[model samples]
Each structure stands twice: as structure tokens, then as C-alpha cells.
Target chain A: MAITFPVEASHILMFARAVGDPNPVYNPASAPGGVIAPPTFGQAVAQFDPEYHLRPKPGQPWFGSGKTPSGVDKAPSAGGLHAEQHFEYLRPLRPGDVLTVEIKPGATWEKESKRAGKLTFRERIAEYRDQTGELVLIARGVGVTTERPVDQG
Target chain B: MALSASRIKPGDTHSETVVSNLTRTQIVQYAGASGDYNPIHTDEVYTTKAAGYPSVFAHGMLTMGLTGKMLTNYVGDGRLLKFGVRFTNQVWPGDTLVATATVTEVADLVVKLDVVTTNQDGKDVVRGSAEARIDP
Candidate 1:
């Protein structure tokens, strides 16, 4: 699904703070071309994805805990685990730009892991275009689902 | 200031302690800012009891963001053309992370770098590469 992502200066500031980056370019007051977003700031498009499962929506049955240990009876074996992420920037992203994002499935594969049983990896590619439809960034992300939680020891 | 091809060699490196003693609150802050509220990253009850993990962990993107902080600080703002990474290990709370970028190549107006981020235990958590525009 395509989503509209309106990049805002406050959001850039908050993201920069969250990442613990004290760069002047991310500050609206110091940046010459408005506030330039951090490199991973494009990932925040999840906020605009109306159906992003990671976010808890109102009136919906979330998988996270509620009164019970879990709101759902059975958690799926395929859990969300990020394996890889890559971004190619056509230009620096600034607060004034409104982006149109489209995400598509890339590939799926499986592997055996001693630490986490069977691992299923899925790839997703997202393209962000500015208001004028010029490509701004291309992001490729790999997500993994383990049969079991990875062993810490 | 952006790196200059005249000033760097292939083995030249830059390192920074991207984060010291990471906190769960910082993890929560990342989830709120990045809009990825996976329970495994925030909800301790869901993470421990339901997810079968020892504790809520940091998002891979958060680690990438931390590492990117070091990269941008080294390469200068708005200089990156590409950045990529693989999450080799999970980053847990209280982990102090050090990120390093090594110049691998300098050609014309671009520089390629190998990026690695390690935890307090000296284990690589994120490994990747980056390319940035540079000056001659």
C-alpha cells in the first residue's frame, strides 16, 4: 500500500533526539535548508501506514499483553525480527518535503540456525518520492522470523 | 567538514562511542519516534512471557540510527549516498556501543567505508558499509 509521509521539523528533531544525535543539521534553527532528517528518518513512514501491525490500533485485538499475559491465545511462530536494512539517497531529506511511499515484497528464503531453529527471511523494498514524484530514497529491508527465540547463551 | 580524498587513505578510520549504557527508555523513545512499536522492543510483559525472550531488546533500526550518528559525525551532514547494515546480533539494554568507520576506497569525489558497530562485549551487533560524497 502507498502512504503519504509529511516530513515535519518537529518529527526530525524528535527522531534526532531519539537517536542521540546532536547534529546542527537536524536542528531547524541551525540548518540552512530547513531541518535535514537523519539517515534512518525515512523509516518513520511506519507512522503513516494505517495498517502497520507493529502499531496498536484502537478497537483491534493486539498481540501484546492486556489483562492476560497475552491478548491472543497463540502467538505466531513468525515474529518480527529485522535482519538487514539499506538505503540509497538521491538527495538529502528535509522537513518541507512531502513523500509518497510505496513498499513491495522483494524475496523470501529460509535457513537453519542453531541459535534460533529455522529462520525465515523476507525482504521488503520501499521507494520514497517527493511531491513532484522525483525519487528521493530507496530503502531495502530484510526481516527475519525465527521458529523460536534466539538463544542468548 | 566533509572528508577530502587528498587527506584519507584506505585504512584510515574514525570511531565513536555511539551510545553508552543504553536504556530501555531510549528504546521506548526510538519506538515512539520511528513508529515501530513491536512489543518485543517495548512491552516487557509481552516480550518476556509471550515472546520467550530474556528481555525487551533494541530495534535494529535504532542501532542503525546510532551507528549513523557516528557516520554522519565523521563524514559530515548530507554527504551520504548509501548506507547499509546487517544485524549480526541483538542489542540489549545497558549495552554500550562503539561504532567505527574505515575508509576502504577513495575515488574521485566519493569515498567508500566499512562500518561496524560493537557492543561492550566486543561482539559485532551491526556490520555494513557506507558511501559518501567527498572533496578532492
Candidate 2:
């Protein structure tokens, strides 16, 4: 899936606030060519992704209460979690620039976990480019979902 | 403020950050901003009653995002070539957070750092490393 975001001063400003960042550079009045965004501003663009799978779907329960987006129906627990994240920035991002991002599923792996029994890890990649098709940034998210942790004696 | 690529060294350590206390509002807003409504990071009801956590925890991305903010403070945005983190502890509301970077490598126009986040209690909540281009 692809994402198009018309970078706004509000998003840049509010995102900084959301993370409790008090940098004045994020304010348009302070920075050149409008303010630049935080490094992880790339992730905030996911809100516009129509196919984003983390939200509560019609059949999926909220807060992973019953069944999570992983299509697994299990009792609510703190099992599925974000394991790792990476971002490769090709250039600086600023308000008023339209960023087009293309996302694709990456690789998957599994491992044994003492807390969660068996764990399955999956990755998704996002490539961000400008309207001119110039590459800007690349982001990868790795998530871990617990299958069933066996009880230890 | 672009960092001087020539002055960087493997042992050099310089990182700037905007420290802030975790808040529920930020958690919910991040959920709206990031399209991650997992509830474990925002919903106190489901998180406490069902998940069995004492309260909803902060999103790992939020801490990582703050670390990104730290990078921007030094090199400006879009200069980072690589940044990553491993979660170590659950971030609770009211926790004080600071993201830091210590230089680990400086070679071939690239600077690598050992990044970490700690709470006001001085406990590490996240550990990982990042790499960025030293030249703008």
C-alpha cells in the first residue's frame, strides 16, 4: 500500500508535543523553509493508511481484548508487542512537502521465549519518497506475537 | 545544527534531548497519530482488567520518536541513515524520559551511536543503537 501525506505544521507541532518534545525548531517561526519533523514522523503518517491493520476492525475486539489483529483469538494479555524498529533517512522532511510512502510486508521469523512460550516475529517496510519520486526515508517495524508460553514447573 | 563530521570519534559522546514526563493524553494522541489503537498503550480499562497490567504503558515508538527528536537536535531531520531500539522495560505514565546517544563508531562519513532511554528512577526502559551520516 502507498501513503500520501501533505506535511502540515500542525502534524509536526503536535507530534512533537505528543512525544513531549519541546524543541522550538519544530515551530515554523523558528526553522527555515518551514519547520522540519522529528525522525520518527514517518510513523505518524500511518494514521492516513486506509489499510492499517492495528486498529479495531469490525470483527476484531478493541484493545486486543478478545482477538487481536494477528487473527488470533486469545485471552487478553500483554503478549503481542513491538520488538524493534529502524529508520533510514535519506533527507530532511519539512512542512508543505508531500511525502509518498509505499509499504510492503518483509520477512518473518520465530523463536522460543521464556515469558511467551513461542514467539512469532514479523516485519513490514515503508519507503518514503517525495512527489518528485526522490527517495527520502525508509522505515521498518518488527512486531512480536506470542503463541502459547508453556507453564514451567 | 549539523555536527562536525571531522571532529567525531569512536569515543566521543554528545547528545541533546527534550525530556518530558509521560502522559495519557500523549498516549492517546500518538494512537491517533500512528494508527496504532492496540489499547494496551491507551486503554486503562482493558489494559488493567484484561491484560492485568497495573496501568497502560507507553508505546515503544513514542520513546523511539523522542530519540529521533534527539537526533534532529544535532543533525537536523532527514540526515539519519539508521536508528533502532530494543525495549527493556514497560514505560508507565508519569515516568520521566530522556533519549541519549553515545558515539561508538565514526568511519566512512557515518557515525554510529549506542542509544538508550531511561526513566526518572534511573532505570533503563530502552536500549539499542543508531547510525547516521556525519556530513550534511
Q: In lDDT terms, which candidate is top?
A: 1
The 10-residue segment of model 2 chain A with minimum total lDDT is A62-71
lDDT digits (tens) for residues B1-136 of candidate 1: 8988899989999999999999999999999999998888988888898889988899999999999999999988899999999999999999999999999999988999999999999999999999999988
Each model's lDDT comes to 0.93, 0.75
Off by over 4 Å in 1: none
Clashes in model 2: which pairs? A91-B78, A117-A149
DockQ for all models, in order?
0.84, 0.56
Residue A94 lDDT, candidate 2, scale 0-100: 80
Q: How does chain A of candidate 1 score by TM-score against the true chain A?
A: 0.95
lDDT score of model 1? Answer: 0.93
